[model samples]
Target: MLYDEFNSYKNFVGADVFKNKATEKTDILKNLNPAFPVREYQKEALGRFYYYVEEYHQKQKPIHLMFNMATGSGKTLIMVANLLYFYQKGYRNFIFLLALATLSKIEGGGQI
Candidate 1:
């Protein structure tokens, strides 16, 4: 009975609804230009990230991203830009955990 109820609910929503939502969200994101103009290299990096994310989804695997970059290399800028991009694409909740030094620098308005 519970399984039948769940199936009925699924039927009402349709199996492809989530995929459609993801596609629509991605389309909207692609149309948006981030506040910070992305450099050529950054654009290439972002393209690769997007490609890997899509590939993971296609394989039905969970996506895990790690941005490994050197200090003084605009890592924070890239992170902020990506956050804004995702926020525009319907993401709302974000928890930014930073080290003590980094947090102090951000609080001091030294870095973003």
Candidate 2:
């Protein structure tokens, strides 16, 4: 499965891959609204994503990744972090796919 492969790669790189790198980009997280605090898992997700992107960049490989998380697990926060990271990396455009339920939850002020 995809997660298994990711885990294998992560293992080869050691536990350092899980370190929270998002907080290091204070310029990005500093701009977030005070009402929304990013959780530890979200930071770890961003860290893993950054590690994956860097490794792929070094190999000149196409960058593509999927974040598998449970409902209401704060995936949107991770996406926002990624957008900020990419923008910092000089990217301008982005697109995100969300389920209708997720949209309603966000619109309804439910936890995302």
After TM-score superposition, the amount by which residue 96's alpha carbon in candidate 2 deviates from its true location, in angstroms, is 1.7
Quick one: how many clashes does candidate 2 have?
Answer: 0
Model 2 poorest 10 in a row by lDDT: 54-63
TM-score, every prediction: 0.50, 0.71
Candidate 2 clashes between residue pairs 3 or more apart in a chain or in different chains = none
Tens-digit per-residue lDDT, 1-112, candidate 2: 5456657877887755666455677888876655678888777787777766765444334666778899878887778778888898999988867675655756446433
* Per-residue lDDT over 8-42 for candidate 1, one digit per residue giving the tens place of the 0 to 100 score: 64478775433343344454345434434445445
Error of 1 at 92 (Å): 0.4
Clashes of each: 0, 0
Model 1 earns a TM-score of 0.50
Q: lDDT value for candidate 2? A: 0.71
